[model samples]
Target chain A: MSNQSLVDAEWALSHLDDAKVVFIEVDEDTEAYAGNHIKNAIALNWKTDLQDPIRRDFVNKEQFEALLSAKGVSNDDTVVLYGGNNNWFAAYAFWYFKLYGHSDVRLLDGGRKKWELDGRELVSDVPSRAATKYVAKDQDLSIRSFREDVLKAIGTQNLVDVRSPDEYAGRLLAPAHLPQEAARIGGHIPTAANIPWSKAANEDGSFKSIDELKALYEGAGVDLNKDTIAYCRIGERSAHSWFVLHELLGVKNVSNYDGSWTEYGSLVGVPVAVGDEPGTA
Target chain B: MSGCGAVVGGVSLDNVDITNQAVIQGVISSGNAPASVGYARLLDRNDEFVAEVPISKQGEFRFFTVAGDWTIVALIPGANSRTPVQATIGKILDVDIAVIK
Candidate 1:
């Protein structure tokens, strides 16, 4: 099935009890889910659930299958994800699921923030369902990028740094208030463009209009025809941008550099440019 | 404020001037304590809440500040009291928070 990238709160509400639909809440703060979350929603921890504890990368395929199976998520189920931080962790989960070849995942547009702001129902009660075996395909590398790929794309201008201007300029490594998405050094990959990830959303945490989105990216010289790699401090924010570009805008060759600035900025001998602008080589 | 109006990290660029600031990045973990939910509060030297964000499952957190020393306290869910962690920032600082349970 061709996955619909975004679903509204009302749609999610109506489908909450549907057998074919499963609701998952991905949050950085693992305790947020336990406090009060959408009824029947299972929580996915952005850190422990998504990553391999022994490695710096994601969990392997067996672990992925087991996690889904334990959560009662079968291969054919349509997974709906929503969470805190404007769905930052949700988008990251969306990307992670897609990486493991799940084809029917969708994001709850505006996430938990909008749901709470709109006075939607939230329950502390958890749901338990009989576990189902989930068969996962191999990881899809096409939607993910590595540091080497970013290095090769230097000067091509297709790499987009979705961090703030100060972080992009080397004036700051990250926002003083947002240290969770920080790196060791400030600046951006050479030849990349600075298009802050938040531009894709509206004041209410919902996405901007389609025309507005097209104009926003086009204004930044991000042509949809060519391959594009979007990155932020780590990867969650950039996954939001990736969802906008690849899913909403239907751009063909967009990938999230999940390693992002955390990896690119810490590497030795990798060229980086500092200034308000993304200078070319 | 004089640049093309762009929204950055949920704030409008027209309002924020980041010409000079320091960044502090770190992960907050309790050595053997169970993972807790909630946010970490960034405090000034006088112990005021300057800013806060939810702590990650891996205990990751970040903060941006002017050039100076600062302190933070974990606001984990179901925990009695959180010990304060400290850091100093010039341009950038990496200080991991290991909460004393």
Candidate 2:
């Protein structure tokens, strides 16, 4: 069954004080929330709230439940997410909530940028809610792929590398200025096709229309009927594509390789292909 | 383990004048809300990418660099506020900075 996908800023503003609706800003930098945020919004950092601190993975079911409970979110509450970086991180968090079976989640259309551009109000007043127990469902593994899963799908023509052209071709380790985000090596997993994540979004940081998204993926040879796996340097960008294909375009069998290039690149033994030098593989 | 030295990999963090290198660390604030997943980018004076690190769970992030006057910008995933702070990297640099959102 498909979930309701997006909520516009107008819808969000009207429901600011709804008891069963929770607005969550999943930003990379926590500081953004402290200064000014959507009124009655609670903050969830993609790293600390969602990630497994001890491991390079998402938090466990218990951790996820605790986070929501502590944040006053009940399983019945509608969780709405938005962020700064064109909603890539927000989309990643959206994918996380979905994997854990939160069925009522929605992404804020155009994210925080569109909201602000329209002259919406932001506040520094922190509102407290009565905490409720949160129940987390078992993770749906079909939507998340690990390294072993990626290995099994190698050379299958459905593994999509959703990074920039430079990253796909190994022209740069990471964004030149963002060196700390680089992987141990350059290049993508063997047999993965290059389909940068930015292509799925409009210039305004909102997703493209459904027809446009469908054509974009089909043009990239992403078969909606077949099992597809998407990856990026750190899995966040790929998650954006994952949302576009699976949620927006109605692709049924897509999985996000959260380990992505960072894990794959650091591996000791795996087939890697750099795209710039054709036939190098 | 919270500074640039602890963020190791992709580049060799070695051979700095032990007395001259400093650590830049701080919370990436939006307002009173702090974030844990964004990055702090260290750019050369010419606006070139030098290095970046993810913000920590406690809303803190860091970078290690040699003594120099550098520009540091905070980046959140969807925001494009590029309000950068001019940081002087010396023996030890402690800063409280914000990400332009």
Please name the candidate that would achieve the greatest DockQ relative to the true structure.
1
DockQ of each: 0.10, 0.07
The stretch of ten residues in a row with the least summed lDDT in candidate 1 chain A is: A174-183
Tens-place lDDT digits, model 2, residues A1-281: 12378888778888999989999988766776787789999999877788788978789999999999999998988999997666777889899999999979899987875665455788999989888899999999999999999888886538888876666777555542232332277788777888777677664567878778778877976566768999987788888899888887778699999888878988997888887432223
Alpha-carbon interface RMSD for all candidates, in angstroms: 11.5, 9.4
CAPRI grade, predicted model 2 = incorrect
Candidate 2 regions exceeding 4 Å error are: A1-3, A180-183, A277-281, B1-101
Candidate 1 local Cα displacement, residue A145, angstroms: 0.4
The TM-scores, chain A only, for the candidates as listed are: 0.95, 0.94
State TM-scores per candidate: 0.75, 0.73
For model 1, state the Cα shift of residue A265 in Å: 0.8
The local distance difference test score of each candidate is: 0.73, 0.71
